[model samples]
Target: MHVVAHTEQPLQAHALIRAAASQPALLPLAQQLTDQCWGLLPGVHRLRFALRGDVPQNTHPASPPLTRDRLSLTLCVGPHADWPEFAEVLRAHTTGACETPVELAALQARIVTIIGAGVAGAGTARALAERGWQVTVLDAGQAPAAGASGLPVGVVAPHTSHDDSGVSRLSRAGLRLMEQTMRELLIEGVDWGCTGVRERRLPGKTRRAGVPLSWLNEHAHTANDWTHKAPPPAPDDAFWHPRGAWLKPAPLVRALLAHPNIHWQGNAKVEALRFIPHEAHLSHASTNTARWQVLQGSTVLAESSRVVLAAGPGSAALIATATEDGSAPRINPLRGQISWGLMADLPSGAHMPATPVNGHGSFVHKLASPEGPAWYTGATYDRIHGDARLLDSDHAENLERLKALEPDTAAALAPLFATVGSDAPRVHGWAGVRCGVHDRLPMMGRVPHAPEGLYMNTAMGSRGLTLALLCGELLAAQWHGEPLPVEGRLAQFLSATRFRSNA
Candidate 1:
């Protein structure tokens, strides 16, 4: 193995070492450096040392002594004037001696274009950039979170099934990864929370009857024993999820796209993908160097060797353009609406719950708003296309569900109900469209029989918050030939190729 280190300032070099030491992924390398008693040597110092034994003494005047079986280390001081050279050397050492796949190895220091500024696109860009790839994100809208991710608040929780099904397992894994990401990147209380969620069993719903309360409480939570005496009086048995929380999606999306290697371009909608053959570019160009031109009508938006289509519903059209057969996955638009009202609008005796309640409809308590403390509820799901307009009927439906779920709270807020959706000062809301597939699972991975560099991460449906980051990690892992963040079977389950047979 070989290791190379470089930095302009001595303090920067030490900081790099400290950072590596603290990172769980690089701690082993840090330990090796510690055992070798490596110091801040001036200029460039090359050493050959064994990992299993003591450091070897210098034997040659011009070169450091080499043990029978040892790794080589090189340290370069001063500014990195030639970044390309440094990146190549760093890539070579990190990838080891030709062990990395030829295709993945060629992608090092290359550029990748991601279309979409939503959670999926931003997450994918962040992952690729973290691996040293230059990532450019282009969106049709003027800024990030212009799609379904533009919602005011979204809940994050692992799905539960009686048999621990594939969706359940995948969601559990995704939830864990998302929680870790929030801890590392988001501000607690402001950006997100672990305040827990109360799921009320709807009337006549018996799907959870066979499941044990202890199991539900352990995996999700029945009640916060420390804070509340009993579960909310809505369901036969209200289930509590301590790990579940709500987040402001826009902030998280911005934070993910803030990476130094990621470049965000708004209003650069990609209308189509034109695959350029490797032979067309150059007679002997590497297959991995195949390029694709992203187009906006007749204009070319950008060109790159790699492209990730994560534009939600818009991804299906791009995939169709790239395919020779003009075939694309069946991505349907599911319209949803959420209703919110000021906290002061509640009747004199009516009060909001301390925690969010989820049943046929979901309710969030005391979300901080510019106007004042506000509560949000409802989110009517309808299979409608191109209907972003808010409907008073949907608002009424949401109120009905809330009345069924929490009669006390509903009765208390009766005063606001008379004026709901009539431009009432106390009542407000927003609506957006979410994309979903027939199977309810997200479509991800390389697009089959399309361009070699084309990939898709779409149809996330309502679980975008929980699944986007994990899917991005999976895509980057596959592209880099690294160990997958998810199991092989699960990755296969989410593959975009699954729909090809049907198409």
Candidate 2:
């Protein structure tokens, strides 16, 4: 079983408290209960409790509070079972408060009914549900992908390399998988397109050794390997293809919610998970519950022999909270910003380089804009602490850097950049965080030495659009006991086990 101790002073916690105390007169009772729990659990830090889903909800309650100010709130979650004994214990504690014991009991009952709504839970639920598994996706948010998946547009395409490398392999594979799935599913406005990507070769650029290269030919990139030779005119001819595409990240995430067998619930955050020899128990908080109670707010969502963790960066934290050994590779959060521009005209037939710009630390791509001829040149990779809000300085610097690469294209891109609301026609832009893995490849595979059931797929970094579908399939392979099509060496390259062992 895993235990998560989360502290929230604003928003969620406050909202939960307010909802419980909606009667106004119940404010004192609510505050008193919250205070009592907080005071007794000083070692709990901001919030503290030990949770093991293994203990049956039918387990009887302990005697009266060691003191009125001290109590343990256990909410039964996951599949509904006979939990009266456990429910009675929770009732025994909340007795003698402003409300009747029956009211408190009802509140505890409501806790287990709400489940969290998020991409990790929801996406997996959808995938499984489509396969005919009964699934429930629960989250603390009112919607799906409210965590790292909340990005407006997740940059799609391979990163760094175009072949065999871990990033490339996963990206190509993911792109193919997503394309296939979306095509079969027919969810519209997701904006799947084959917009070709183009790049201007720098004067003295060199490819990274050991990095496999593809698609570039006599005309693809401007050759700067030889000095004193002016680079050839940009590839105006439609000779090659490193074609790219974009997806409205939000709507696509929401579309995943359409699965029939998947139950998407919001305002419930998993507090704990208990692993029995054969079964697993889940503990979580809900909106309707007055205080935490076992089985009251809980429902057995799924009792699969396996469970996967696609929780993005939060997966590491969740794993850390659950494991007694406290061993799991931490996810690295990388921040990347994208700058958009209104283009007078993008080269009609020319293909752009969808791969990341190496030393320049930026990426440029085309966007489907209602306005005429629009392009997005972007993405400043800043690992340091900062805000997601776009910065003018970053914009100026990006433009200058972009201009230096292709002066001719810069002339055409400039006015468009300005008109978009910057110094040029480019007025709109955006920023999002990438959950990157320290090894620079995605983190995948089963959590090492833990129960065989737990699995993870995260840290796709700048390649979410190109990598999500592929990674999901990889996880599915493991869950189904099927041989992974990806090479074993590549699997090791992306394994979470590598980090856990190294650390």
Candidate 3:
């Protein structure tokens, strides 16, 4: 259910949301309304009330979810004057306030097949499963997170730009959503940590991106909790992200796939998709039926009325099979490598950062590794390279990048980098290939120029840990006509159709 409430008075709205506290029967539902709605601030805000297991009675759906058992609620706060604009947004997204379109309803079957078992696939599956869809996740690997989502530890900090760019704003939304999800599904210390990230925004001469060299942001003071200037002596370009985090992507993938409504099938490498357009035997009315058979070299792996390609780079191939023009998203592979080692092996007088840091690259320490307490650094980005092999040369590249990130820390770790032999336990390397487009934003929604049931949710790049869950939620929101998790303008930036050529 989606709701838009308009009022000049926010205190009244706040009080009404808290009204659930008055009824003992409604206490459980009260816990889900946990956002600092409106912040009691002037701007528009949104709060979610998502329930599972035991749900309370509320307003019935104006438009039902893909499955009729929709248990989610979204409240969009705005003024009465904005009704025209709000209504337009609803119409553009094809939300459920009106009768479902015949074509749209055909893709709403309760069963769905999701390609890949990484963060993108698992996140999409979880969102659909919660809405009562029986989701089958197929992965080419033997286990979840066997791709880029297998990164040992990655940061989930919001992107910060001086002007609060669209990507930055979308990242904030993703981070907020992730904060709630981590609390609900995963163990705090073991699976993830809200350990704040300290970003050393270096100069443009040293890196591809950075904060303003002069260090003044007109908007920082207002959103201080999200991003702000670091304290004195911490470099004028430096930043502090209080809500940032470091997470093990694999555990998150596992947790998302664990939903009872989601079934994960490993080693099911999808080679193609066969479209079967047939006529349905309707008792009351005749209808067109659309179904997709997931194939692996003529062998059917799974069949469903809807198929979503969250298969990272592999989605390009599957989309080709269903598109009449052989059109597919041009997602490129970006490979990155990180260096890590046991903390106990550090030489005397050597030091590691007290927290995670990023700018030129990223460095994280005190994280638990299989070799015991460990520190990680680097992650040199190599574009268009699908190779994920650990290389001594790449380790050197990481150390060089880390020097630009943290000079003292890099200097201290030089000994370990210099002595890393085949059997060396002091230093190690891990590499993985991530996918992205030229714009750096992800491509999602239903695939353009393809069959109706085909969807793409890949190209997260290095921000997979930061953006995957939000992309998944956005994909679900679009399909179900639910209130979008982010603004409409920001959502449009992620659409793959933006890349389509015009005459």
Estimated TM-score for each candidate: 0.76, 0.57, 0.86
Please identify model 3 stretches exceeding 4 Å from their true place: 1-46, 49-56, 59-104, 205-222, 279-288, 422-425
Best by lDDT: 3
**Cα lDDT for residue 144, model 2?**
77
Better of 1 and 2 by lDDT: 1
Q: Please identify which of the two predictions, 1 or 3, would achieve the higher TM-score against the true structure.
A: 3
Q: Model 3, poorest ten-residue lDDT window?
A: 36-45
lDDT of 2 at 147: 59
CA lDDT, every prediction?
0.72, 0.46, 0.76
Error of 2 at 480 (Å): 1.4
Tell me the spans in candidate 2 whose CA falls farther than 4 Å from its real position. Answer: 1-126, 139-141, 158-163, 186-190, 199-239, 267-306, 341-374, 404-409, 412-426, 500-503
**Candidate 1 lDDT:** 0.72
